[model samples]
Target: MAKTIFNTSEKSNFILNMTEEQYSKLASRGLIASMLLVPLFTIIPEVTDKASYAFSAGGLAVGGVICMILALIGMMKKYIGKGAVIPVIAMGALVLWGVISLINGYDLNISMYGYHNRGEGLLAILFYFGFFTTAAAVKRETAVKTLINGIVAVGILNSAVSLIQIFITNKHYQFVSVDDEAMAASGLSMSPIFLAMVLTLALAAALIGFVTSESKKRRILFICSAALFSFVIMFTYTIVGICGLVFSAAAAIAAVFALKAPKSRLVSVLAAAVPAALAVVLVYAGAIGNITSYRTYDGRIAWWADAYMRASASGNFNSDIINIDDPVDVYTYMNEKTVDIIQKNPLTGTGPEQLAFPQVRKVNDLTEIEDIMTANDGIFDKDYNEYLYTAATRGIPSLIALVLALVPALLIGYKSMRKRKSAEAFTAFVLTLSGVLMFFISCSSIAYAPIFWAAAGTACAAIEKPKKKEATEKSANKSVKAEKEAAEKPAKKNTKAEKKA
Candidate 1:
């Protein structure tokens, strides 16, 4: 009668009744699956023509949704830590701002779907959500290790493919063109620059894995992967790709010192530099000079100069001094136009779609800033710089939200590095630093943005240590130990007394 009243058999049927360890194990599987799928979906298309890049986006979305659901379930079960609250709120605010900006701005269809061939609108929001969910839910140390291994595996695979494309296929390292002859390893991405960004992050992950791993075999595997990634970066020959490597290396070195990790880890990380420097030397020494041209460097310098001169001239530079028809002229023009738009609409300047599309405006009797916007219509998809683009389109609120979303992750890493001497803390520091570097240098495309956001989330989740919980646990442990010691001392006294009696 008492057992029937309790209904013990039905208790197992309750979803929330699951233990924390059980929930964590379930969430870990989902996190690993998502991490694996993100790279597999991205890299498979480069090897096979049957699959499109959209499949990659689809895979990322599916993985993200799965992780998000699992994360919500973990939240219900109280498996996720309270330390994750700030990051969750920040990411949520970012998504909310994006939606609000889309609603207030121009074309609904474009804002929702993004531009042709580039689905960065609503899908990007989902990607960020997935990132946040994965970070919040995947709290177990085993899950974090699985994620790192997945990253290293992807990096090694991509590196092999790129090596083949460069050596066997004899393809050029092109950034804009899809022609097989131009880009050696496009890796299902639209450009080599994008692929390079992914590879750089993977390389960093591999280095972390190598340093933290105690197993000899695992360390060797990670070292091989790191070497391959370095080769691929050198072969890609994209300026941004090279810049990303520099940023990644800088981040790695900074993280090593900041986390107080072993100095040997720094040496291992910098080992990639030998190959990178050799590749650069080869390029300059005329071994690969024909394939790698310095024209792009010159063009970028000219572009920066023109932007500066135009801004200095208050967007009224004489056409005689600077050719209005030149492509470099657009950077200055767009910069000025973006400033004007932000000044007019500080809250919500325009929609996401408007930012991607051409915005024409007559500046004065002598100049008009329509050429660059029109030129960017189909040629160059984004604003090249993500921060400027976000500020111009979604206003200051969205930009602030986007920035805020990253801050908690960085703080988590910093705090972990300061407090913990474990490998997890070091890994979190490097991952966060890599994401921040990529955001500053690369365009925030769906392909790259998801990875960056996921890294941020994973870093946060890896180091979720609430002070109150820790204190309570320490106090409880101390009390139990004291009780045992006191009980033991009385028992020993009684045994001696009995022997004497």
Candidate 2:
């Protein structure tokens, strides 16, 4: 049964083994590549200039491609499972985006050549997809824990550097000095996404550590570290960065409450009191009023209003007319457009990145105003709208597929919730759900931020089995061994007596 159920690939001895010397060489090479490429991408123009292009293409892209090739090879050798579905779906989306761009595109040549091939554009997308796929393949909880630890370690090191820089240079940022020019030289500056991600991971680790820590010293250290990281996140003030931290905190608290309910009723009651207290404090301090002035929220409201208006004016359901002057009229208009688009292209969308529908095109035209032009020449600024972007980029089917991808993760979280597993897993699931909701909101404001990845990685990692399960299995095995030995002794004696007779 074992033979039929599992691969016997161990018999083939296909795995590569490295001597100490070979291992040393590989480690050295990896370090050299990291040192050379990190600063190169950090200081220079992001992913657009020649040097940046080469670094991303050769360093990041090549690394991802290598991983993908190795994964494929492993699959062929039966060393990896056929659960290669996500990568396939993501890659398929890329292909669909490309092909559809050609069929109904304003810029056919650029579309075919991979959107001006900017920033090692196509290759970079491929790399990230492969990187995610590799991450998904990691099965061991220890390995996942180690990866989270590494991120936390880096964040700690970077935070230390940030503190030093703040004191020595009298600047706030460490890895990326908050210099006047605002160019990023370090993780904190250049990759706020990475920074925010690490911050959340460190917090998550600290929470888990605190809960499980037996030693007072370790608990104090972890609690202090978590507090410091939270401070650092606040100082950075990347709106999304702050939001990610907030989301993570809320999720973590919620998970703790859920997990504590069964064993400690008093503690759970106290935990429940926290939100009520915080809400009271917020109202007292006028923090709730402060939320009204939030730039991101204000901007989104304005943008959505405008979109509703435009969609209504055109009498075109496919166009984004929801951003109109009259909310009542615009709302009516958008419903009509939704009905129209659903009637026309209910399944696969208008094709990836092809928003030539009259309504979208009108907004595309309006956004060309000098006041509204964003970094990407405004072609991608207002196009920042996610659902609209999804509809435009991959049409309806791909949009639906993206929604479907979201479902599995949520279901896993729900299942974990039902089982009353580790607090970390429940926190992760709720945080991920919140992050996904935030991502939808962010689609209209900011593009894909790194915090999304951080939240996602945490949520995915949280679903893993706890270390105690393995210990339990080992203990069960030991008990079984003792029982078997006791039974065998009696049988052996009878056999020996029979032979002697």
Q: What is the TM-score of each candidate against the true structure?
A: 0.73, 0.54
> What Cα-based lDDT does every candidate model obtain?
0.60, 0.40
Q: For residues 1-501, write the lDDT of model 2, one tens digit per residue.
A: 112224545435333432222322332232223222323343343323443222322444445455455434433433322433543464447545545534664444423332221222334344434433333344334443344444345446545644443334422122221122211112333333334444555555555445444567865665656655655544333444456556555554554556653232223223223432443344345443222121122122222212222111111122243433343443344344444554565454444323334333333445432222221111221232345455554456545655554555566556655664654455445545755565443341111222233234334322234457789999999999999999999999999999999
Which digits, one per residue and each the tens of the lDDT, describe model 1 over residues 417-490? 66766666566567777767665545566556655666677666644334677899999999999999999999
In candidate 2, stretches whose alpha carbon ends up further than 4 angstroms from where it belongs are 1-40, 43-59, 73-99, 102-120, 154-225, 236-238, 259-385, 416-420, 423-431, 443-501
For model 1, what is the alpha-carbon lDDT of residue 231?
63
Model 1 regions lying over 4 Å from their true place: 1-15, 42-52, 170-184, 250-266, 281-345, 360-379, 462-501
Minimum summed lDDT over a 10-residue window in model 1 is located at 305-314
- Candidate 1 lDDT score at position 165: 62
lDDT of 1: 0.60
